[model samples]
Target: MAVSTASPTGSFGPPPPTTAGAIVVEGLRKRYGSDGPEAVKGIDFSVAQGEIFGLLGPNGAGKTTTIGVITTRVRPTGGRVLVDGLDVTQDQVAVKLRLAIVPQRPNLDRSLSALENLTFHAAYFGFSRKARRERALELLEQVGLAGREDDRVDQYSGGMAQRLIIARALIHRPQILILDEPTTGLDPQSRLFLWDTMRDLQSRGTTLILTTHDMAEADQLCDRIAIVDHGEVIALDTPRGLRKLLPSEQGVEVVVVAAGDAGTGTGDPLEAVRSTPGVERADVVAEAEGRTTVRAYGAVDAGDLVDRLKRAGLELVELRQLEGSLEDVFVHLTGRELR
Candidate 1:
């Protein structure tokens, strides 16, 4: 039997010791109206302190709704969400004090300078005039905006604007940082730079909860990931751990070379291979130079596949095993790839 990865284990009672986790969500749920569709069904998970935990799923999978509940932006129909030991419902003010959220979109005031934006945000936390300026300068330097402190935010590039927003979120020194699609439209270089910034924050002991549809981003950054679908958590585990849950631990790729004028003549060699015993799934990934490349998943017997190909009057050009990946596990669990 194939093994299944379950959600993070925990109880729904009051908050645990601070060392247990930075965020505890028990039976978290939300619905737009009394009869409206349930955006977030009953779900539970925990984010350990100082760890970069990821909520990974396609659009409308409840990633954003769950974050809404944790940040107290959307009220939950039923659940217990504790941020740094304070319940989000009863301790909203206290919860807000311990966490900072960087939304999916840029919310900076384009009219204000980068320094001015951070300065105003710090003021809300009650920093004095002198203190706010000092903190803003320090943060600008930290986010690599030291020289651009006085530049208007409207003039900043997308990456620079994102960095400033992150700096603004840190003005009050939040213990937990929540980012929703932190690099949605960033270029490759920008995305890599942002990843470096995330690593730096983790090194400083800031627990991060980020939502992303980018599989590579989640695999590269998160210590643990929760694959949510249809408003429920389908699987949760470390990247390496999740990859192990695939129904087919091994993959096989085969290239067929048909003889003579029979070249590339195939009614469906891919489907024929899928019907073979022990083959979980098969797809024709490519075709070129009178050859068809087939990707087969599962504990496929290479010898048996080669024999079947021979019986089908096809010649074997090449064969190899494919490495397991998280995308395979995700498709197996969710029944669909990320959109």
Candidate 2:
């Protein structure tokens, strides 16, 4: 169904065929009240056509608010959002018709059966009875819920319910799909199931915008990720590209017998580690069972680190490369982990 008419800033016309990208945000900003804190502080980014873009950030970082604005559920206090070159403020109805949103929480009717919910949502898009039935059945089978169509939504498992929600969102065959924390609380099996569904959609040339706290999920699915913190894009790159931002880009964990064993009796182990070849920085990260675990960052050389440890009279209990990851980059840039 069409959304409420928008003000003059929005448009009622169709988009041109040669738009540069699927979605673009220029200096987007949002604040609750006259004196309220700015939830989004003028962030800019863009999603290419048929690309899976991710928004990764901690809670209250304005990820949800940004999605809400692009989906036209919330209005921006400043800046502009364009979907298919259609300004969100000026083309509310046209933009709404082009995109579908699967929110963080499922909003299906508890009283309605799965089939009922899909068909009901289809009706809002002006589908005929026969069309709704065909569309509902097709989506049900596509989402692997063909046999559970008559069951009440409340009876479905968390994963099953989420699948139904996705099916409902696709009832109108939107060009863009926005998923907010789509796999936040699913079991491994369910998570993988939903991932396959998402991959299928992308293969069919659907543009996807995703927001999630799961770094691994983002790494696995997103073609590029924008890390937002305090309403800013702190980092924007592919998973591998983001990992390269970490200092040292490579690391190794060394377990020493004692702090003093890795240096002079009164010297600092961290200092000794830093002085080692290829060791950019080293810090004692853990202590347990009379052993000290030091993580050395940089392009760590195992042989060099081991030789240095031996020269300091330190016994190397273990040495292994520490893989860099998106999470490392997130913590590095945000100064705090995703809560």
Candidate 3:
């Protein structure tokens, strides 16, 4: 079966491909306990080949359950999953060969060296000793871990370990890579490094299915994102497309630069904002002692709001139209942000 998905721009491509990067899921449902509630309530979406598909959701959403079912770590009570047209349930053995999963946590054997870890992983897939060794070194170099190839896994930093995990997932060059919160605990530099690596992999025709709470990552990488919540698919679209769905009455925030007892926004800044042509409401934020922040939510232009503030005897330091991110979109759509 073919999966017809809308692009990030909310458009369609030529009809679904037959052999190329195609994934299909229909009425996908999975429940943990026989008598308990179902974790996944018949959700469905597909990943295109060479495309980065991001799975996003709040805590307790069925994101993990959906991944587990597709990867065959858990069985679906009723549904269909096909990777490259291979039925996940019927051909579990073969599907495993074509799929690689990067779990949310670092599961590397602490005692094993980087080289040893990849070597062991490769051998598990039946690679010859020499082949495993060569491939391990090659992948280490690819992920910029060549210098640390001999380092013990336990000593590897969060980012370094993530790279190794990604490289290990690619040792066999699976058609699809599933990443669950791959960069959760990493520093800024490490997160950026992983982003680069992901781009490189996509260039080589590797389909990527990833999950992350980081809005920037999803916006930068994912061709489309599936916003899951409470065991259901709430929204699925490109990051930009999702942003467009925000309420027409977008809000603008302004920081006050008033002088002489500016602590309580004593001046007329609030009046100036409310008087703006498009501004529906505005007020000073008392969260900070010296900071006077004004936030307005309505069909108002941020530029106009800024202009109004300047004319009202208030200096414009910085002004921005805040259209909350994917997290905000999730919260607006699902009534909660993904943890």
lDDT (0 to 1) per candidate:
0.82, 0.82, 0.78
The alpha-carbon RMSD values of the candidates against the true structure, listed in the order shown, are 9.0, 8.0, 8.2
Q: In model 2, which regions exceed 4 Å deviation?
A: 1-18, 251-322, 337-339
lDDT of 1: 0.82
- Give each model's clash number: 0, 7, 3
**Compared with the true structure, what per-residue lDDT tens digits does model 2 show for residues 291-321?**
7788988887788777677776677788877
lDDT of 3 by residue, 1-339 (tens): 111122223221122234664577789888778788888998989888889999888777888888887898888998888988888889887778778889999899899999999999888877778877877897888778888888999998788888899888877777777889988998988888878777877786778898887878898899999988888888899987887678843777778776543444436778878987876666676435555777877877777777666666566666777666766686688774335
Q: Write the per-residue lDDT of candidate 1 for residues 1-339, one digit (tens) a residue.
A: 111111122211122236557999999889999999998888999998889999988789999999998998989999889888788999998788777888999999999999999989888777778877877887788777889999999999998999899889877777788999998998987788678777877886778998997888999999999999989998999988898787566678989877555444453568657867788788898999878999888878888888777766678889997766777777778876445
State model 2's lDDT: 0.82
In terms of lDDT, the poorest run of 10 residues in model 2 is 1-10
**Sort order, lDDT high to low:** 2, 1, 3
> In model 1, which runs have C-alpha deviations exceeding 4 angstroms?
1-19, 251-322, 337-339
Clash total of candidate 2: 7
Error of 3 at 87 (Å): 1.0
Candidate 2 at 258: error in angstroms? 27
TM-score of model 3 relative to the true fold?
A: 0.74
